[model samples]
Target: MTTHVQLHDRLDYQSVMPLMEELKAITDDDLVIDAGNLRHLGTLPLQVILAAVKQRAARGQTTRLANASDGCVDMLSLFGFTPETLTQPEVWT
Candidate 1:
């Protein structure tokens, strides 16, 4: 099953906890997307993604992000996380 989190606006500290809960509820291996709707992603938001990635890694699951705004891309690069940022996907669903 795929879990898609469409972040239409700001993705900051306020959004993380609720998203974590939603992600926790997901069963079976799946995908998560902070998709086309996302606009701004602050430092806390980037950290949130990092944390989620680590958590999923621990569980042997995978999470892929998509449609990151240019600002989001800049922020990821600013934080030195560009390598992990999902830009083009081999298979996007």
Candidate 2:
């Protein structure tokens, strides 16, 4: 099964709890995170994403961060992360 979640426009401290809940609720084999609306990516949510990725990795599930906007990509790059790096479990460490 694949669970797809559309990310909010701002992934900051204010969005962490709900975002975490959304990610945590996924019980599928594939997790598809649609980040096309992102305008800002904060450190806290970045951790949340990494944790989710690791969790999926440990469970042998797969995750994909897709359709990110240019600003979203820039934000990830600011933190030294590319879209590919976000999904690869090994890069989290």
1-93 per-residue lDDT for model 2 (tens digits):
888899989888998999898899898999999999989899999999999999998999999999989998999999898998998979767
lDDT, candidates in the order shown: 0.63, 0.91
Q: What is the TM-score of each candidate against the true structure?
A: 0.71, 0.95
Worst window of 10 by summed lDDT in candidate 2: 84-93
Model 2 superposed RMSD (Cα): 0.8
Top candidate on TM-score is: 2
Q: Model 2, stretches more than 4 Å misplaced?
A: none
Scored by Cα lDDT, where does model 1 land? 0.63
Candidate achieving the largest lDDT: 2
